[model samples]
Target: MRIYELGDGTPEVSVVGAIHGDEPCGERAIERFVDEEPTVERPVKLIVANEEALDAGRRFIDEDLNRAFPGDPDADTHEGRLAHALSREIRGTTVLSLHSTQSYAEPFALVDEVDAVTRSICPHLPIEYLVETGRFSEGRLIEHAHTVEVECGLQGSEEAAANAYWILRAFLSATGVLPAPVAGDTEPPLSLRRRDADEVVVFRLLDQIPKGPAEEYRVFVDNFQRVAPGDRVAAADGEAFSADTEFYPVLLSANGYDDVFGYAADRVGTLA
Candidate 1:
């Protein structure tokens, strides 16, 4: 991990990038921030994590770093030690971990729970959807207090990089680390792009669509859409898999992962 402190005093805000090495949008965003050299009102720490995996252009060297949070420093795996180090770095701080997904092309926020902090910070992001992990957040980075994760956009896309950069700037501005725009500024600062209304759709993760013993699989329903009973969600080995209960697909993807098709979620309610 590479740490860049962009002001004096103890850092109260942190932005972590490249938790998954294959997702480089966050890293690109961080690099752009560094290049701009924006003056911050408060101290902030920018971390480029999983450098080894990033160098190799793989997800990770041994394990998924995002899944190995609060890890052991004495562990054998590289990610375990890195996770431990990262946990220490962002202890007691408001953290924003950046990520990209194959299932969604638009940015969205993810949190362990919808608390005061989440409610405040999520609206500052350029996202209309907020997914509360519930039990599914067990080992994620967002499991930690005051930490929020975001899927910026589709992995490796230019749009994803732009989204990540804008979101990071917005997060900093919202958190008061970066100053808001002044009068007569030609372009609108990131803070201005934040959703004015408090209406945000919240989705609670229900279950995962586990991949069974099959040669191939395909997903039909669009993500974030309601999947009614008997609606065909996916297919494996030419056999169709329909929803048995009313649910919404969040990360529904055909070949996104090997162990599961994606996730089934329920629209809990809107957050204001």
Candidate 2:
């Protein structure tokens, strides 16, 4: 784990790089932020956990880093051990983990209900979407750390990089690390919700694509889209079907590698 020093105040924010190897945009974005180091005085720590997995340029060598957070110290994998240590180190750390997705969703903050502090600080950035954990999924980094995960954009996509640039500056400014927002950036009033009933849904990556060729026409869709029953979503070999009922899904991902194991949801009406 590497810490980049820029600001001068007490450490309050610990922004994380890619916990997953395949989603290296956050790692790359952090590097860019370091190169043009902002003058933040606050104790803002930035780290890239699971270096080996990240180096592999794959999601993980054995286990997913995001799911490994707050793990047992005696865990078998390096990622697990790292998560255990990292969790302890950042126990009281105000954290933000940048992430990306396949859909062109706007940059959003997906955090747990416990992260009211992070929710309080949301307005410092220009993200329109603020997702809650149950609203997205379990076993995610933000859920594990009880921190905030900002969806910058599609993983490795240009949007992810571009958003990371300005969002980093906004983070520095909002955290009082930087005296002001970075150039060409104005902090948008963050849409902080304790939880959006309408935003409730679990997300997953579809992994088991059908085993035959020419049946690969279906692609991932954005979160919260309506799925009609029997609607052929995508097919690996068999005819993939959708729910017959009318329920809104918070579709966090539209597509990824052929990992057809995505999430299904049961939303509890959100609080206004």
Candidate 3:
């Protein structure tokens, strides 16, 4: 149970990092901010979720921490108990939950539909991949606090770290934690959805990945971009598989019982 809190004016914001221990890249990034001790006009709390797992250097010791939010106090697992405590900590605060994707894509922000909070939020996140995150399971911290989960992009890359850096800066400025806004509201050329529906489909659970290091075969050329049937989307066992001859197949995102990362198949021109 490690909690990092800085800034001492009024408690208006809280940022959560790494519900999944293996996804600790965000934890490292946020800790950098906390250690720097940025002066603030308000109070901000940085919570290191699943500290036990963090210490062990794993994603989660018991269960998927993200799914366990708004937890039951009587949870039997350590992760679930932490989720319960965290839910109580983040009530009514603007939250920036950090994440990393296996996708080679640079970085993106997953937000809900356009609305007051989202409008104010979009401008702050420099990464441009904004997609609807649905209402999501009730009582998750982000849902509880109008929070947006930021995907820092491919784990273990300097580029990904840089993405987190710039976005976090924009966030700090927008919240008036830092000096000023780096840029005014910039509407991304594409809407929250991908530019092409046939390009890619986003999914969780990676049962379809080839297996072992064979998982390396799965590659994404674009960030949830679309493709057509017979197009090379992602690789299974590092081998490109042609898309199925259906519109739905063009938007193929496959997950089975093997991987946590679901996939996309290249559907070439089917949507066209």
Report every candidate's CA lDDT: 0.88, 0.61, 0.58
Candidate 3 stretches with Cα past 4 Å from truth are 135-141, 181-221, 229-272
Q: Write the per-residue lDDT of candidate 2 for residues 1-272, one digit (tens) a residue.
A: 66664556546677787777777767887888788755556668788776777787778877877777567789998777877877865667777787777654457666665345654566566664454555344556676544767777777777677676667666767666667645676543342222332332332332222223443435434455655666545444454555555433443332454444343433333311
List the candidate 1 regions with Cα displacement exceeding 4 Å: 181-198
Runs in model 2 deviating more than 4 A are 8-10, 135-138, 144-146, 180-221, 226-238, 251-261, 264-272
Q: Which candidate's TM-score is highest?
A: 1
| Two-way TM-score contest, 1 vs 2, winner | 1
Q: What local lDDT score does residue 252 receive in model 3, on the 0 to 100 scale?
A: 25
TM per prediction: 0.94, 0.74, 0.72
lDDT for position 212 in model 2: 36
Each model's number of backbone clashes? Answer: 0, 33, 22
lDDT of 1 at 77: 96
Model 1: clashing residue pairs?
none
Residue 1, candidate 2: alpha-carbon lDDT: 64
Worst 10 residues of 3 by lDDT: 263-272
